[model samples]
Target chain A: MPVKSLKKYVGVPRDVVANFHGKQVVYVSWDQHLLFAAPLMLCLPPQTTFRELVDGPLAALIAPDPDAAAVDWSTVQWLKANQPWVPDFDRSLADNGIVHKDQLRLSTPGLNSLRPAA
Target chain B: MDMKTEKKTLNLKERYRLLTRDLGWEPSYRSADEVFPYVKYEGIKVHDWGKWEDPFRLTMDAYWKYQAEKERKFYAIVDAHAQNNGHLNITDARYLSALKLFLQAISPGEYAAGKGFARVGREFPGVGTQVACQMQALDEIRHAQTQIHALSNYNKYYDGFHAFADARDRIWYTSVARSFFDDAMSAGPFEFMIAIGFSFEYVLTNLLFVPFMSGAAYNGDMATVTFGFSAQSDEARHMTLGLECIKFMLEQDPDNLPIVQGWIDKWFWRGFRVLGLVSTMMDYMLPKRVMSWREAWEIYGVENGGALFRDLARYGVRPPKGWDDAEKAIDHMSHQIMLGLYQWSFGTSFHSWIPSDDDMEWLAKKYPTTFDKYYRPRWNHIKKLAAAGTPFKNFGLAKLCQCCQLPVVFTEPDDPTLLCNRETVYEGEKYHFCSDGCQQVFENEPEKYVQAWLPMPQLFQMFDGDVAAWMDWVSLRDGHDNGDYDGSRDQQNFQQWRGLATSNQ
Candidate 1:
């Protein structure tokens, strides 16, 4: 039924914009790490930090389901590809020097079972 | 009695004028509006029909003679190639997938162009312009015929080359091309010129033809290369016609400038979206890569197209909108599209394979910034999964963009990782686009595009939501032709054919 439900939403996650040459692009994985969604295109104005994005656009875009409990902000780990999870919400995406279109998997404190053991 | 004999002979220019412009007949009872009603609706202003230029001075007599000679020479090569088993000379059997794609996706587009140009040729008010359109109509038809003839030999040895016109109408991926031409055909004559003639022929033809022909040359498919060369000469005149049409429109009235610019913006993005297929072929499908898609885009799109816009700046024309987004997309479009095609090969007419390590290294060298860091890892993972006996293929249908009909695979402009899902509600129904450009195209002419023949919805309605039934309805034989290349019928056949040849040798 879920797969059929996906068919109703006529699009797949195939378009990956890979042109981040000579710029700092941060990759943050979202949605329980089950789906390989495209990264957020950061065209925010200057002086806008990653913290602002998480609080404002990202939170609004990926708010927890009403049926599910709210996700704790501080307990979420920002893990890079093949790297251990790091809990640092204060650092900006620009400060992380993330390459454009790179994969950044999100890990919550108790949601380790949702992700493959890494 | 000796009579003074005198005869008058017209020069080339004078003969061209007499043959083209002087041949128009005025209606005795009917008004011009009644005769040429379709030209006035698109809001394109043309004050002087005399201003339309016939730069090639092409007449029907000369056209027939020249084209007949080229056809003669072209078919000779096709015959030779077929007799010599030229299919075996290709770099690898896998390379024919590119040719198969060209046949199914692009060759039918030529036939559509023929029909569109014929309509425009009859409807336009200017005689000279009509003659030019008529010639191009003939050229487009010839292009379709020659391509089909050139590739018909491969049908005996391959699976995808058969039932191309059927596939173009029914296949999900083929809709990317069909919908584009359908859009152009349904517009007014002037907009048709801008959409197909200018945006497609002049702006993006090089990126489409050059790499494919060169790829053909590198792979020893002489017949295909010959077809490309023959079609290209006609393309030169078509390019001139495209340029002439735009300039004539802009020079006629200042009122036409904004309209022309809007069409350019709309059609350029549309044309670029169609070229997504060609981009994948140039980068991934060719066994011996002729040039990188990025390199081809820079030369054909950025340098030449940028210069053309700069030259036109004197007439208040700038480059098309979304130029920046297109430039950025060049780095990742081919890589992204190949992954999609490889994963979905089971549903397609052709086979797909993972790039070898050597191919990946070459891609890394070509795309120094992104390939090594971003794409290579994903590919490595896919290859590992495939080795572990779990290859990726989408079992469910994909949602296609309402405008381009391509699978919504494009990411956001500024960020490469995020999917750019843009939608607008029209007539209480929401329409989705892959990017802002496509969304803008839809919003501009919602009435025209809202009627787009999207394959997925049609499949659901017509085939009871079964992909296998849909494939059967479309004439694509499953397992026999479509799937991974390693153990498919085509690959196995090629191995057998080559083995026999080796034994005889």
Candidate 2:
């Protein structure tokens, strides 16, 4: 039998998010529409890439099935068919002193580093 | 008399009980140092290891059986969930960013500790720490594996999960965790307990694990939270071990009082600095956030830790050396760090704008000190952008502490605006970090954290050359974030599971 589309307000309860056992997920809102996916939790604009969104924390949470057959990329022709928008780094990070990877960042020395001058 | 001595044998259980309780012998040595040399140099003295009590009365068989049972229960849950395509909400797999960070930055550190303890156990054979170390070694391995297994279930559904374990071997920021653990493992057994167990687990873990699991639960993820809490129970045991070890050291000798107090002082501050990330996450990460870092600090740090220390003071143990500094920083650090992360979080982890008016109202009530005074103006801008139908763009590079990896948001000792900034020049180049604790770390052994190969550099390196090859490599390694739970094997299984469930209903 074919899987039906999740019904509006009536299908699955929103709190079912807590019931999930294996994967980490977040609800991202695009205007009024809500999209559910695993890994990234941000409410991204329509253009973020699959690559940029998958971070280290999210990557470590995914468990693989022991008996699943090997994956074939040829089946994923749909991703190539649809061009998704990639996310750009936001500007506010700098105000907090966070440097982009391309930029040179400075850290303050620790207190332990300060000795009664040698 | 001969007839009475004739045939009596104790059973295995009785023998273990008697042996563990009775095996200890009083030292017949030139000095206590000849028997336990390592305990003295670190400035910690233990008058009695015998005074330490294991609350569970966990003899060896009970330990093995209970531990095995726990593993069995956890794996059973893992299997059932996996069989059902238990990954929930399409967004569920995307949140792997947190797991990625844990595996790469924190998981290997746990394993490293196991190795470290194995060595420490050998060095300090008589101290009860060897047993504690053994338990921790096993617990750390369990933590690493359980974390990997829980997350591995999502590998089929997500990207980036695979690269993280490898990333631990390479990342610079990761060195913060690695170096912190190495420092503990290399220190005397007493300091190791203070640093990793007492300071890290007891005082700081609630800040890290509670918020993290709550975030997982709030985000509609169950498996991650389960694993996190499961590992955390073991953390609680470790905490007990730590407290016991410290008290034992302090009571062991008259001279150990000052020494043990100093170790407590040093390790507490060291572990506290590392919790900056946790502070940010607790305060900012979850959509449905829990107790603010301010409240958490007040309750756990001030109330619990402060009170605990007060009780210990009755025994001549003083509060940790830098307790005041920690208290002063707690009021502001999490907010400053979160404000920074909110700006740069785009394309990393799950990015979201700063708090809404409702959220700010909650924060103001929770953190009356700095929220209104310093943080409100900043949130107003973010709020304005959200209202204007513009999600705030990424913020700039927040200065990370070279040692602790926290952003340089610490206020100058007593002042907030004048950033509590410090730096050191090792071998002619300047290295900056946030606090005296971290600075001491870098200065003590500049060679360690300096050797770290940051992940951002590696990612950029991959991106700069061989575009197709890099994309392909990173996609397999990082897990592509393509929208739509459309075509992965996990998604397909999810569909099948959904189909079956609904049909049954």
Candidate 3:
């Protein structure tokens, strides 16, 4: 469906990768973790390795969750834009096919984020 | 015999007709299409201009007299409320968060409505519609001013009320409202009326207004309550105009049904997204609760809105497409939104806190089905985190829905635990929505949403991606303006002042 307008109507999206000063906006959703409101948006360089994201910014972002320290990355599953993608920890984000504005759903299979014996 | 001819003054109804209905002349030099360029663009065909009616038959002279009387009474109460140190009279300083949110996020929308109505009034070909829109323009501006006037007292004695106008454009949370108005104001005249006048005023105003007014009355905010009372008549007039326009459009032609239905579907969901903020405020912000957001929705949204759609059914109009989803959401929306707010309190102008034990108990009783099962445990996690001296905060920003401009905090309707995330690739740029309803709205009009200056994305792009710079850009004074309600300056001052107001020590 198109916009009902008097003139030509399609517009350039404001959040395209070109506008973000060499960084791509990636959304991280921790499965079953309702505490962090919504997915956290992180602006990262395209070359940042998958391992660096987990140990650095991703680690800091999910630091408040009690389950963060217990996650087994080897067994954890990842979905990028609704499709399953295995994490090559040594590979860059661009190599993993995670582009700008893509949402990566990190589902820890056995690690449900229920009230963790607090 | 030629007797002296005496003239009697025109009656109110006659004067109203003379002033409003009789005040149009067709353009001779320019074509109608040239004169009103936006009228035919949306494809709503109007056969007659005479069908539009103002139920009150209000003329400029009578309108002035009525509004002037209201102003006199309202200002008097405002002055008294200020002079009497009424700031200390609220149920708690915590209640001020609702006021701050109202002023910052919602009052500016009133001003936007005023501007939208004025622009559409000029574009509309019908003289009656022009008159109605003109009158509503004045009403909306008045509502904005009076709301600011009522809440300005709190500015002198509060933390978060200082930069409401600035906050409307710059803050992250308020973009939901600001962008909503921007979307309406930028659209064609017919869509503007459907979006603001009918969908907003007729269908959703009660959910927004009733809670604030009744909350004010219940919480002892005399100034806010007085403003609410003063705006009551104008609100009624606005509602009448909304209903009249919707009915007129439906009656104009059979071709308009789909167009009108599409708008109703779009704006109802849009309005529902904005109301999610109000739902949180009603449930969590009020110190002395009037009713839970769930109760208010059942009454105002489901009950009153049901009767309205039933009447509209005669015109072959059904309820909004998002109506059933909204019903299922009432149980969980407030809790989800409040939890988000509590965690993200670090970024907001208003204070947020974990609900007290009593407050949680109230919530548990109100939402017995979902609260304990899904939300209560989350709050308990946050509570323990705060008690351990590291209060939880989502330090990063959130991705916003392109259409509604709200963060995608809402969850799947059936599963309370999973976030309801919807996205589509429009012109190679991916856009996200919080629900199917919002997604459908975006898919219909990709052009308008693509240009939306989303605050979060731009914060990184424009504000050097620095937290302090973003805070400075948004006019938040770090520690003072943002954070938890407990131990904040607002709390300390209220407790100390209330002590001084009552005690001899």
Best by lDDT: 3
Q: Per-residue CA lDDT of candidate 3, range B235-301, in tens?
A: 8999998999999899989999999999999999999999999998898899888898899988988
TM-score of 2: 0.65
Instruction: Summarize candidate 2's per-residue lDDT along B35-138 as a digit string, tens digits.
Output: 65665555544445656665444456666777788888788877876887666542433244455566666778778767766666655635345556667778
Which one wins by TM-score: 2 or 3? 3
For model 1, what is the C-alpha lDDT against the true structure? 0.77
> By the TM-score metric, which is better: model 1 or model 2?
1
True contacts kept of 1: 0.01
i-RMSD values for every candidate model: 17.0, 23.5, 2.1
Local distance difference test values of all predictions, in order: 0.77, 0.55, 0.89
Report residue B1 deviation for candidate 2 (angstroms). 33
True contacts kept of each: 0.01, 0.00, 0.84
Candidate numbers sorted by TM-score from highest down:
3, 1, 2
